[model samples]
Target: MVELQAATKLDAVFHALGDATRRHMLRDLAGGERSVGELAAPFEISLAAASKHIKALERAGLVRRTVAGRKHLCRLEARPLEGAHEWLGFYKQFWSGRLDILESLLRQEDAAKSQGEDHD
Candidate 1:
């Protein structure tokens, strides 16, 4: 049950990250907290569209928004990214190990071929 919940959250995180605009927003927020207008400034998007992207990040636990008078200040939450990183890290390690083994096998094959040539 807990794993399922985690997977669902990860899905949201990946979905949020899947958009280039959202990724740029995340990158901007990484510098510091920014108002919705500030976040929208770099892209040719209206405040409503920017709000929608921020909402997606919020749903994914990637960004936290706080109301300050008329301004909505958004800051990067970043904890959810840790879960995503861990999930990707597992596959990274798996692929790295597999590649290492393949390289070793290729090196051994090359050595055998060299020895055969020398003997001939």
Candidate 2:
């Protein structure tokens, strides 16, 4: 059995998503369930290479697999990602306040520029 701390789950999710190939795989899985072949169709990599990336995602708990006959179907398991969202929410409020201040400063600058132009 595998378990991740709530605090550390975001780190795991972001680290697994750092790869371009894995990002593409995630986009495809977002549309619906897919087999490894369907997920690998757009890429030029070998099946073995794609499988390695999939394994990383599986370990991170972002993807779940169900084996049927000889095929494995991969589905998105997004509950783990809520940890990432919760982490980001903290920074969002801080940034929005900073951006609001910047917007006011910019407006003042623009008003001063227009006043100077009127004199010219």
Top candidate when judged by lDDT against the true structure: 1
The C-alpha lDDT values of all candidates are 0.98, 0.87
lDDT for 39 (candidate 1): 97
TM-score of each candidate structure, all chains considered together: 0.91, 0.84
Lowest lDDT 10-residue stretch of candidate 2 = 1-10
Worst 10 residues of 1 by lDDT: 78-87
In candidate 1, list every pair of residues with a backbone clash: none
**Per-residue lDDT over 16-99 for candidate 2, one digit per residue giving the tens place of the 0 to 100 score:** 889999989988999999999888889998888888889988977999989899887899988877877787888999999999
- Tens-place lDDT per residue, model 1, 2-115, is 999999999999999999999999999999999999999999999999999999999999999999899999999999999999999999999999999999999999999999
Mark the regions of model 1 whose C-alpha exceeds 4 Å error after superposition: none
Q: Note the residue pairs that clash in candidate 2.
A: none
Q: What lDDT is obtained when candidate 1 is compared to the true structure?
A: 0.98
RMSD of each: 1.4, 3.0
